[model samples]
Target: MSPLNWGVDSAAIADEELLSCVKNNYGMPDFWGRYLSTVPGASEGLTTNEINFLKSNGIKIMPIYNNFRNTVGKQQGIVAARNAIYRAKRLGIKDGTVLFANIERFFEVDANWLIGWVETMFSSTYRPGYYHDPVQGNFNEAYCQAVAQSELVKNQSILWSAEPQTGVSSKTKIPRFRPQKPDCYATVWAWQYGRNSTECPIDTVLADQKLYNLMY
Candidate 1:
C-alpha cells in the first residue's frame, strides 16, 4: 500500500465518492502523498509534533521517496533512488513499501542503485518493490525471471502490491490470481496486471479492509 505516488495522478481521484472509495480501500497502504519536504530549505522532516500525533493515535509512519530530484530511467534517478532507500533506512522508515518508479529501458537494471537496494532493503526492511516497464527481451529471460535477479520482486514473497491496471472495476472478476485468499485489504481491489481480465489483488483487499478499518 502507500505511495499515493501515482494515485496523485488520477483525475478520477477528485470524485468524492471515488476518492472516498480509494481512501477507504487504499489510503493507509498508500503513503502520505505530498506531506514530506525533503530538501534543506524545506520546512519538514518528521517533526516531533507529527511524530507525537502519530504515536498518540497509534499511527505507523512510512514516509515515501528518496527524492523527487531525478527522472526514473536516468542515471541520476538511479542514484537518487538509492539515496532515498538509504535515507529511509537511516530514519527507520523502512517497513511499509516503496514504489520502484522505474528501471526503464534507458537505465540498466543492474545499476548500483538497484543492487544496493536489494542488499540494504532485504537486510533491514520488509517492503514492496515497484519497478519499471519490462523490456522486450531482458537479456534473454534474466529480466523475465526476476526471482534470481531482483530480490524484492521475488514472486514467492508476494511482497509487492501493484496498481490496478488503468481499466476495469471490482465488478470484473479474474479467477486464477484471486489473491490466494488472504483477507488483507492491502491485497484486494483487483488490478488487471496480466492479459487476464480480472485479478483481485492488493487494491481489492484495500476496498474491503478500509471499509471497516477506517481512519482520517
Candidate 2:
C-alpha cells in the first residue's frame, strides 16, 4: 500500500497565525484543503494571500468548489465545473490540478450530475473530484450508479470519502487508515477520518500518495 500523509481541511480561513498555531499544535500537514468559493454555513473561500502563504510554507493545496446547494442535473453540473475552472484560473491555479466538487450529505446528488461533472472536467485543464461520503446514503448510491454507467467517471474522476469519522486526534495520535469502502470501484484518493474538530477549526484527512499529483 502507498504511504498515507496527514492533512487538514477547514471551513474557516486558515491565516498565517492560525496555520502557525496548527503547525505548532497538530504538526505541519502535507496538504491543506481550501475552498475556491465559499459555501454558506460551511466554508470560506481561499484568498490570494492565503494561497501564497500556503505555497511559500511548502504546504500543498487541495482546491474545493462548494457553490451548489443542490446537485440538480447535467446543465447545473456543467455550469458548476465552468465556475470552478474560472475561479481556479483567476487564482492562478495551473493546469492539471484536481478541482473537487463538494457534495455535502444533504444535497440531492444524481447520476446525471456526476456524468456532467466528469465530462466537463475531462474537457478542461483541471481534473474532476468529488468530496462525498461513500459509505451509504443517496450520494453513494448515485455515484455508484453513475460509475457503473459511465466509464469516464469510473476511470478518471477521483473520490474523497468522508466516512468512519474518528473525531479529532492529536498530532502524536493520528488515527489508523480504515475509511469505509465505497459501494463501487472508484479512485478513492483521500479519506476524511475526522471532522468538526473541537480543538481546531479543521477536519483531519489521510491522503494516498496518488492524491499528491492532483494537488497544487
Candidate 3:
C-alpha cells in the first residue's frame, strides 16, 4: 500500500488543463472515478482516447454505476445492477470489470436490497462493489451485514468507504489512508477523504493500486 496522496475522481473527465493542474498542483492520481450512467454530463460516457490517456498516464479508472433512483428493495437492486451492467457493456467495459455501485447518502441501505445488487452484478458481467459510508464497524453495517450473511459478496467484491478524515489542516491537503477498524468486510479497498472539497479539484480517495488492479 502507498501513502495517502492527492488524487481526483469525478464524473467530469479532466481536460488537458485539468490534467495539467492535477500533475502540477497535486500529483499523479492513483485512480479515478468514471461515470457509467446516462447522467447529463456523463451521458457521452467514456471514450477510447480517455482510456488510453489514463492508462498511458498511469492512472487506473474506477468505473461508477450511478442509479439516480433509489434501490431499496431486492427487485430494485436487481434491476439497477442489471441496468448498470448494460451501460458498462455499452461503454466497451468488458465483463469481470469491478464497478462501484454509487449509493448516495440520501438512500437508506437495506440488507436484502444491497445483496441483490451485488449478487446480480457478480453473477453477470461485472464484479460488484459498494461506494458507501461504513458506520460503526465496517462489516457491521446493514449493507455489510447483508453481504456477510449471504454468499453474494465474494473475495473479489471491493469496498470503498466515504469517510472523510477528521482534524485535518484547514489548508487544502490530501489525507492519509487510515481505514477504520473492524470493517464489515475483511478489507477496505479505498477511502474517500475529500468530497467535492477544496482539498482537490474533485472528490478524491486513497486506494491500494494492487487491490484496484483486480478489477482492471
Candidate 4:
C-alpha cells in the first residue's frame, strides 16, 4: 500500500487549517468541486498558494470534483469527466489523483456513457483505475455496482472510493455491501489522506475500499 491516502474533505480551506493539517500530517483534499462551482467563486478552488503548500507537505494526490452535468439522470457527467481529466493534466496532477465526480445524485449515471468514458480515461497520465463517491441509495439501481466493479478491474485499477453515508445518522442500519475486503480501497483512501486513519470509516465504506484495493 502507498504511504499516502489518509485524507479529509472540506469545501474551502483556510490557510491555517491547511497548515494545521500539515502540522498534524493529514493530507488535504479541499473539496473543490463544491457541487460544481455553480456560484462563480462561491466555492474554493485550490489556489496557487495552496498548491505550493501541498507540494511543501508532500501531498500530491488531490481529489477535486469535475462538473458532472447530471440532472435528469441521463449522465452527461461524462462530459465533465473528460474535462476534469484535461484539468488534471494541465495542473500536473496524476490521472488517478482526480478521485471522483460526485454526481448531482448517485445512480443517475448513464451506464453506457460511463463505460465509454473509462475507456478513454485510462490512457491519461492519471493512475487509479476508477473511483466515485459511493453514496448510499446510489447503487439502488443494482447493475451499476457490478458494471462499475467490472470496469475498475478491467482497468487493473486500485479502489472505488465511495462515501459510506453522511450525517452520522445510519451507522447501525447499513450492512456490509461486499463480502471480501478490497485492498485498493485502502490504497485509495490512504493515498487520499496522503494513511489509514483518514479514509472513510465504513463498516460498509471501510470494507468496500479494502475489497477494491485488492483488485490489482
Candidate 5:
C-alpha cells in the first residue's frame, strides 16, 4: 500500500487565526489546501499576508480553484484558468504550484472543458490536480472516464480524492474511500478523509508522526 499522510483543508479559515494557532498551539496541520476563488472571476483569493505567513511558516500549500456552480464549457476553460492563475499570482502563490480544480459533488464536468482547463494550467507554469469524492459521487467517476478516454488529459492530471468521515489512520477500521484507477488517476496524491469540523479534526491529523516534516 502507498504510504498515507495527514493534513487539513478549509474554505473558511481566517488568516490571523490560522497563523496564531499554527505558531502558538502545539498542534497544527502539516499542509493547507486553501480555496483560491469560489467562481471563475477575480473573486476572494487569499490575502498577501496569509500567503506569506503560510510560506514563512514552511507550510505546504495546495490551492483549490472552484467554479462548480458556474457554467464552464470548453470555450470558457481558458478564461477560467487565466482568472484562477491571476488570482493565485496576486496572492503570492508562485508558479509551478500544483493547483487542484475543484469538482464539487453533483456537478457534471465536461470532459473537453476539464481537459482544456488542465492544459491551460500546464502551459501557465502550474500543475493540475482534481479534487472530488472518489466513490460516492458521480463526478469522481465521470472525471475518471474523461481522463481515460483522453490521452491528452491522462498525462496532465493528479487526483485528490475526498472521502470524508475517516482519517489517514483510523483505529476503528472503517472502510475508506479510494478512487478507482485510470478512471481516477493511477495514484492519489492526497485524500481528504475528514474535515476540521468533524471526524479526524485538524489537531489530530497535524499530530501524526508520519506528517512531521509536512510543515517543515
Candidate 6:
C-alpha cells in the first residue's frame, strides 16, 4: 500500500486567510473536503474563489454532499444523487471526480438506498462514494448486504470510514494512519481519524494514495 496522505474536512468555509493560517500553523494538507451545498445557517459550501485558492495552493478537493438526514428508500437515494450532481456541476467540478454522500453516524442507512446511490452514480459522469461509520450500531449489516447484492456497488464504489474516534491532534503531531476497517468487503479510500479539532474547525483524515485519482 502507498503511504497515506494527510488531509482535512470542514463544515465552515475556509477562506484564503483562514487557509493560509491553517497552512502556517498546521502542516499543509494533501486535500481538503468541502461541502457541495450551502445549508442556510449550518455549513458553508465551496465558492469559485475558494476553489481557485485551494487549487493554486496545491490542495486537492474532495466534494461532499450532506443534505440528507436519513437514507430511506431507492427513490430518495436517487433524488440525493441527482441533487449532488447538480450542485457539483454548478461548482465546476470536473467529470469522473468522486462525489461523496455523507451519511452521519446517527443517520439510518439501508441497502436499498445504497444500491440506488451506487447505481445512479455509476450511470453519471461522476463516481460514487460514501462516508459512514460501518461499525457503528447496525450500519455494517446494511452496508454489507448492499455490497453483496450489487456488484456495481461492490466493484465501483469507494468508501470513507468514520470509525475509531481518535480525537484531534496537533499539526506536527498527526497520529499514525491506523483507521478502523469495515467488517464488509469494500474499498475504503479514506479514514476520518481525528474530528472537530480545537485548533481549527476541521476534521483530520488520512487517505489511500489511490484516492488522489478520484479527486476534483
Top candidate when judged by TM-score against the true structure: 2
Tens-place lDDT digits, model 2, residues 93-146: 889999999988778889999999999999999999999987555888888888
The model with the greater TM-score, 3 or 5, is 3
Q: lDDT at 175 for candidate 1? A: 27
Query: Relative to the true structure, how large is the alpha-carbon lDDT of every model?
Result: 0.34, 0.87, 0.67, 0.39, 0.59, 0.85
TM-score of 6: 0.94
- Predicted structure 5, TM vs. truth: 0.73
Candidate 5 lDDT tens digits, 1-216? 434444456665436565455434323445677778643342345566666777676666667787445424676666767777887777767666777777766666666667677778888877776776666646655566667776656776766766544533332332343533334454455666544543322322221222222222
Stretches of candidate 6 exceeding 4 Å from the true structure: 170-172
Candidate 6 yields a Cα-based lDDT of 0.85
Distance (Å) between predicted and true CA of 111, model 6? 0.4
State how far residue 17 of model 6 sits from its true place (Å): 2.8
Give candidate 1's whole-model lDDT. 0.34
Which lDDT value does model 6 have at 197? 74
lDDT of 5 at 132: 67
Minimum summed lDDT over a 10-residue window in model 6 is located at 168-177
Which sections of candidate 4 miss by over 4 Å?
1-5, 21-42, 71-77, 95-98, 104-107, 128-135, 140-216
Candidate 6 collision pairs: none
* 1-216 per-residue lDDT for model 6 (tens digits): 886778899988777766766677677888999999888765798898889988998999999999877697898899999999999999899999999999877788888898889899989999999998877755677788888899998898898888878876645677776666567788888989888877778888888888877798
Candidate 1's residue-wise lDDT over 1-216, tens digit each? Answer: 431111221211122453345445444222222122344542244444554444354443333342443342335544554565665555444354443332233434433343444444455444333333332313113333444555453431222223333443232332233322122212232222332222212222222222112211
lDDT of 3 by residue, 1-216 (tens): 654434567766655776776666566776667777647744336566777787788877778888556756788888888888887787677667788887766667677777788788878867888777666333336665675777666455677777655432222465556755224554577777666645445666777665566444
Q: Rank the candidates by TM-score, best first.
A: 2, 6, 3, 5, 4, 1
Ranking by lDDT: 2, 6, 3, 5, 4, 1
lDDT of residue 29 for candidate 3: 72
